[model samples]
Target chain A: MIFPPDSLEAIIFNALSETVESMVFEEVVINQFVANKWPQVENSAWWACIELFPPPISGEVIIVVPDALMNRFTEATLGMGDEPPLAEENADALGELLNTLCGRLLAMRVGPTHTFRMGLPKIGRGDTMTQEGNNHKLVDCLVEDDHIYLVVPNQFWDFNAD
Target chain B: MLKILIADDSKTARMIIQRCLEMVGVANCEYVHASDGIEALTIMRAGGVDLLITDLNMPNLDGKGLLLAVKSSPKLTNTPVIVISSLVNQALEIELNSLGVNSIINKPVSPVKLLECMESIMEKGFIS
Candidate 1:
């Protein structure tokens, strides 16, 4: 990883903040009270993941959002009035959000000149758990009162690891 | 009225892009949607599309492939393309420009940005 742990964390936070604010017109703040590790599986309703490939670095970015927050995101993205968005609609919204967030995070970390490729976002509902290891990093955030988690696992920083 | 074709895998993204295009004062236009580049190409082949807006990453053919297909074809070569994506950098921008992309708009797109890009393309006579 080109950035130190703290720097990477800050980058993740900034990317998440900008993505959410721009896409959904909502504010995201770091949830200091929550631990950086993955939260309880039941609390999360949607999990979206995208793989990043940029030369010597590679990893997957996962975004976890609870049911209420997902509803808010879907409604905002689709501009729904009364009827709830379909399951596929929610999945698409989450995937697009993850795609944008991962792209922004990579651009910020890798600079403007370096090119990077990202896989299409894959989204799923129900319980999902993060891989267990010190090789990964997690950032907990809040959109209003709901919690969201951003996880980068495996080779997220393998190049600089001691 | 101009006919615009939007190609993106996500329905949500297509809706948002259409909303932004409307907000950017592209009101008197007919909109067509495609789930990927191949579909967009099919629609273009049918004729009468004034512009093409596409997302970079998609299944069964991407924006780059779509751009190449359109620019290479004699019938579709004149149609303008605008790429909206999150995976943009200087290198990619140069590549897209070389491939005849009229404009590139970053994701989390807004009406102001869309309008600015459209105005620039309009000045170039890509759109009237």
Candidate 2:
């Protein structure tokens, strides 16, 4: 059965919202429209990539957030909101957060009966994170004024492309 | 002090679970950590793990395999296993239940929920 586009969008949004609130202690609302450009801070951005296989679908879910947001996330995960951010810690937190988001999103989409195999999460920063070819799909959820971008690369969606 | 085994490929995950355990007032405890299910099983065989908390997706042997290995073992059958994963669906939940898993706690785990599971298992002695 083909899932409705609107339903898929809502599922992605809900997954992102729940993940951010639980992991980063931040609340966000998904925007209906797409953003003009990627969220970045002084030429730097953070991203986490996860690959999903079989079941309801197979694709890669990539989450990109601004450097400032990464700092806050690092602080929140470590329970030291006042401390300076650590690079390794920030990357690990982002990777883990994306991993959770991907898992929850897949579950919500397909239910408990069908299980999906998720690959280990990888994190990247700055220019290298937003390479120009296949970063098209986006799930833009508002976090205050800033936004977190979730991308499902085109290669993974080709199976369902009509 | 109770002996707890935490298995996840991510160091951050293992750390967070450990912190949550402490926050839930599980102070008198010793932790055994593993980066994957294979390592987790190795630790389990070494003995002394009162509780097993694992993540579903891992490099080798995964959570499902680990659970099966535990259930089939004579010595490890009594040890309760708590799964913490993001891949939770009704189908997965039912499967885990039938497999004799103690509990399934989703990723980005909530402290309150973790506490509740710990208390329930500690009081009841096991999920089954």
Error of 2 at A76 (Å): 0.1
The parts of candidate 2 lying over 4 Å away from their true place are A1-6, A32-43, A130-136, A153-162
Alpha carbon deviation, residue A74, candidate 2 (Å): 1.1
Considering only chain B, report the TM-score of each candidate against the true chain B: 0.97, 0.95
The TM-score of the first chain in every model comes to: 0.83, 0.80
Summarize candidate 2's per-residue lDDT along B1-78 as a digit string, tens digits: 689999988877888899898998887889989999899999999998999999988887898999999999999999
What's the i-RMS for candidate 2 in angstroms? 1.3
* Candidate 1 - chain A - TM: 0.83
Which 10 consecutive residues of model 2 chain A have the lowest summed lDDT?
A153-162
TM-score of 1: 0.91
